[model samples]
Target: MGALAVVAALAVAECSGGSTGASPSAPAPSPSTASATCPSSLAPANPPAPAGAAAGAAPQVKLVVPVDTSTSTVLKPDPAQQLQCGKVQVDTKSDVAFAAPKLANGQAKQLLMDIQVPQTPGPKPLVVYVPGGGFVQDDKQGNLPLRTYAADAGFVVASIQYRVQPDGATYADSIADVKSAIRYLRAHASDYQIDPGKVGVWGDSAGGYLVAMVGVTNGDKQYDLGENLDQSSDVQAVVDKFGASDLSKLESDYDAASQQAAAGLMTVVGKYVNGPASTQPASATPATVAAANPITHIKPTDPPFVIFHGSADTLISPSQTLMLQNALKAAGVQSTRYVVEGAGHGDLSFTGDTKSALQWTSANVAAPLLDFLNQSLKG
Candidate 1:
């Protein structure tokens, strides 16, 4: 954790932590602290033997590219930052780093989750938020807008911070952290007043890819990093905002693009796979890259999905979302796709049905988002 630059978790001081049980009166929302008691019953029903645990837990130095945080001050904001929406309070427990047992480089990384609970609640539904940054940039703090919006919608939101590629971790490592976050919540569900059975995940960009992975690979032991092995990491619903379902597919697009465009696109996806797009699909760096695709994990049992992508997205391409949608349909899984006309990657503000200058607003996306979540999470 030394020169590794591992960001520390935040401390929510103003708000109290831990969950509460059923009560006659309104249950006030409280900040949730890490639980010391990990019940044996909460471990994965069938844990996979630690694959790379015995290897060096060191950081993949080769993949550790330099990231300039100067302009991105938002990456390292006040961990103790708090927001309030009327009687409902939004508190963030930042920098909650968990150890990824699968990492060859035993570098400990942290995750950030913002929790917001409603006043009148029993076991409230939970939504895990994963932000997008091309898998190499951005932090959980960058998800403030989405977190607050979801929190206000009455869903207990946990905006998580997972290790990006620059940290020398692969898609597998990032997914381990994502599943770990879900297990962490379920393990402490009662304390956080969470309905463990009613949980969903929403991610944008790189985060969307991880969420898609999370959705498709519900019980895959390989990605299960032995954390909370007793509890399941399956999510009930998924909101994927222009996330790449398959890196191989995205890289394949680089083939037809001009030299300059391919170079620019590789700058984003290359880091995730730890190599360049010019040498991908057939020979991506991490041999597991193809298997990492959400499409590979698709099955009819998979949870419902709401996919959002800018129809004109040139970054990851709208085709990525379409591919997954087609797979889901063939697999017979319930799915919804929102093709924002004229909208590009991550831009949810397309008011006109056909076209217009891009405008940005939470409501623009939130309307459909909230509806989807309510229909899926609220039973």
Candidate 2:
């Protein structure tokens, strides 16, 4: 099947039942019965907040998503991708629309977010998901496959799409959109029956990088401009799947193939790496990618994190997770990791083409992911 056909097929399977279709090589993350254990990140007195954040206030942010439903659903899950084994009452819902941060056009694109609120309420935890496509591709109109998975496992789940770094747009704008979405979620948690304080952020690939940015810079005054008087939209937990954690380190791994792909991708994402090479060395080095990585920002005060990756991923090395795990351990923070044997980037599939890959990841990564999210989100 063609790309479009594959998507349609996946959609059908998501809406219907199991996807034991074509035996494509690149399978989705496999589903497994065994779950993972999420280390608790709760505090006795009060969950740690940013500097001087008001007590008992939930972190909030503006909804900064852009939706294109032409080929995608109305922010619902693709039938083909639904879990076949686990039939937990997801209690999923839709029509949770909001406006993203304004673009250079003096207006932001309309965002259609898929929200899954728990049946049992009383300020439930929240987990926002960002889909990855190098910041320019992918749609958010359909049910975010990962969000539904997270929701089924527990937390109030959300999947968002940020404005792309078009040929003329800047990367900074994409970053701004993330902050906007956080603010939006924080301000409107009650509407979705979520615990404003227990918000956690997670994403895959480029989405993973976006979540990292959100984690490292949560307290930045520029991005923390929310109306929440009680708390900031600071997340209590994070999960990154093979995202670019450090730019310089990423650049080091930039081979001819990657540079070629990046050259083509840069224009689409609007990354104009212009100007002459600086004469002086940057304050940060590629090796410190780990130190300068989101793991650097990790502390006992920061939210717990769990990262998963394929052991043999070429796009983003598995070693990245090792670095993150080590950092969290050294800092006395809570964390865990799982690596699939032969996955690449963040392809979380287990049927059709990548059925094997999917199966492996499910057995190794996604299942663990559910447990990790459960521990953090279910208080």
Candidate 3:
């Protein structure tokens, strides 16, 4: 028979229950059962014997049946097959060079970033993550769990590498590197399937401070240097995790013990800006120190911010974040601060390497961060 004629015959056989060994009086299968059996239901009831088979022998024939599904009706919708439970698979691209920044030694270095893109259908919002390392070290891959979590949640996360104090790099170089990364993402948004219009930045500790600077100095041109100048480094949302706002006032915010404990960190900060943090002769000048503070750049038109700090943090001082939050509010900006109780600086509760740890972060940090980003960017 022709293909169409065969299919029609199968359909007639199916409707009439003809010669398939199924009793005519047999009860029809339930909707779920029918749907489940639809795949195998098209198998021919009788098959031709193999070419060398004995006359009396029955042989198996695997038939490829074509079914017209356009007119098929789904008797019942499967609750298991719902969009709410759908998850986007995440793909990671590592060590992608975004910029070539000149180091203090005058040697140009390729600044790289590790990006995580979701395999979802549409262009996803972009989130540039800067890792914290006391401004002396840039641990770009330090918090993979958090970065992966953000990626799984549908954001294109680029964990970036910036110049550090050890590279003889100044604060401007680091800030410029960050802004350049943002601009690079925007410039290549189509290549990475990123929604250039919706971009956000998240950082921890010194990195947090950098993101805050990026947030506050939205349209300031000083930091917008090196390639992709056409693209804006403006971020719609900022997440600051235990980052310093005002380096000069950090010591004052801390208690005597904390000041003594974080003295070395203050020295690193001073080195970053090239003058003084809470110590003398570190590297930074008074003007440089003032300019590095995110609070110094805060305006009413800056992006919305969500600052996370641990009450038990002694390194950056939760009060520093509080100072930032208060400054943002005073400037008529939208800022939300969440204090993770009993959690220390860069705590596992915020970074999450294990399942339980991720759960804790999802509940305390990621959930709120996602909510804030969705509202600020997706809206």
Off by over 4 Å in 3: 1-86, 255-258, 275-285, 348-362
lDDT of 3 by residue, 64-177 (tens): 222112221112212222112115566777667777776655667667687888787889999999977556556565666566667767788898888776566667888899
Residue-pair clash count for candidate 3: 5
Output the number of the lDDT-best candidate.
3
Better candidate by TM-score, 1 or 3? 3
Task: Give residue 70's error in model 2 in angstroms.
Answer: 45
Instruction: List all candidate RMSDs to the true structure.
Output: 14.7, 16.1, 26.1
Model 2 per-residue lDDT tens digits across residues 1-379:
2112222332232223222211123333232222222212111112111111222321221112221122211121122332322335555454344443454446444444556665553677888887665444434432244455566556777766565543223434445556666667788877777877777888777677778667766675555432343447577778877676544444334345344433333322223121112222222334433333566566666677777665445445555556666666677777666555444444423112334233322433455667777788775
Best-to-worst lDDT order: 3, 1, 2
Residue 241 in candidate 2, Cα distance off native in Å: 0.6
Lowest summed-lDDT stretch of 10 residues in model 1? 5-14
Runs in model 1 with CA error above 4 Å? 1-87, 97-104, 251-259, 264-271, 274-287, 347-364
What C-alpha lDDT do the candidate models reach, one value each?
0.58, 0.50, 0.65
lDDT for each residue of candidate 1 in 150-222, tens digit (9 for 90 to 100): 6666777777767665455567778888898899889988866789999999998878889999999887877
